[model samples]
Target: MPEGITAECLMENIMEKISDNLPKQKNASFFEDDKSNSMSTQFNRLFGRQKPVHHLLGGGKSADVLLWRDKKISASCLTGATVVWVLFEWLNYNFLTLLSLAIAIGMVAQFAWKTASGMLNRSPSEVPHLVLPEHVFINIGKLVGVEVNRGLNFLQDVACGGNVKQLLGVVLSLWAVAIIGSWCNLLTVVYIGFVAAHTLPVLYERYENEVDGFVSNALDQFQHNYRKLDARVLSRIPTGKFRGKKFE
Candidate 1:
């Protein structure tokens, strides 16, 4: 070969090798980026919570009580609940009867205190008046009203939203509640749930990792089964017009 032509051919061969290597490097980086992105895509934690359990519970005095940060207050709450359950369930006390009895006793005690203080020639200022601030009741009523409205709106939305999964979930939840209510009365169920609310969060917070891992595994398995079920059965269900987009 002539020297000039040989040099040109060699340069072309080198350029071709460089071009081929550049694409391979780019493709490798592209795949690496894709793999990293896939790895970074995290499934949701339990209940889809992105915050710590304390923050999710509002990170306030209420959360403190629920998580038993103040053991005394938490104990007092459980004790009070126990007392109420005992009163209604074991002692068979009607709420109206208890309320009336409590009011009557309070009135008698207040009257007796005033009479005794007067007979003792105690100063009028010595009599302490038991008074409730009106705003306390107003605030409580507002809170209750807001919660009631919210619950009603949620029920209405779930009823009319036409989401099968959501509807089934609500139905199953309500059905479970009904079964529990049948086992005991409403008060028993409420008390049990209140107790669980006080205890479960603390336990979950203590072992969040294990619980999360277990829940994640269970959810994955459930999703796997659900996909199979959807493909085999739910997908076969005739939707006709309802198969289209929900809102649009």
Candidate 2:
């Protein structure tokens, strides 16, 4: 009905308003209070007793809701992964082979361009200095060690702090890594993770408020369910005392 406003533009404006209205941040105290209240409610609901085994069979409605909300992104990622898998199978080329071939072609193209430029300008060739394979390997090894140490420190801090939520997250992450590792080689996983790390963060930053709201809501639901389970079972188990000091 408005001038210069197509249906697509109207839809975009509405989506932007929705994203802007979503919650982006909350205080730490609020989270702490919510956690305490959730645990209390869970304990009260279960009468401080173990829940029935049938409870384990319950479906995650909250997760389903979140997935449905982000169905477009999820479907796109799934389709892209399937396409990549099909291409890999048909071409019979592993990650390393593809990477090496790409690098070789890039280098050859750059060298040819440099040579042509020198010939056209009648000047000295501008060949780039290349590092030896041994040096490259050493540098790569150091980088790997640094990343491994950082990952270890993160786990150590989570464990020492005795944060049940973070500990469970780490454990679940390890399980996911194990499953992914079983499905594909380490190089392929690394390549996919590298691309995702670069891409997902940029997209998230662009839609920060909306993404944060979705994540916060999902986490709240997960914590609510987890607290119920914890009260009914996990709280009954005796974990040995942790010796290390907790880090903030």
Q: Which candidate has the highest lDDT of all?
A: 1
Q: Residue 27 in model 2: shift from native, Å?
A: 22
lDDT of 2 by residue, 79-115 (tens): 6765676557657777798789889998899888878
lDDT of 2: 0.67
The models' CA-based lDDT, in order, is 0.86, 0.67
Worst 10 residues of 1 by lDDT: 239-248
Candidate 2 error regions (>4 Å):
1-90, 93-142, 150-169, 242-248
Off by over 4 Å in 1: 1-44, 118-121, 124-131, 240-248
Question: Each prediction's Cα RMSD?
Answer: 6.2, 20.3
Cα lDDT tens digits for candidate 1, 81-112: 99999999999999999999999998889788
lDDT measured at residue 232 in model 2 versus the true structure, 0 to 100: 95
lDDT at residue 110 of model 2 (Cα atoms): 82
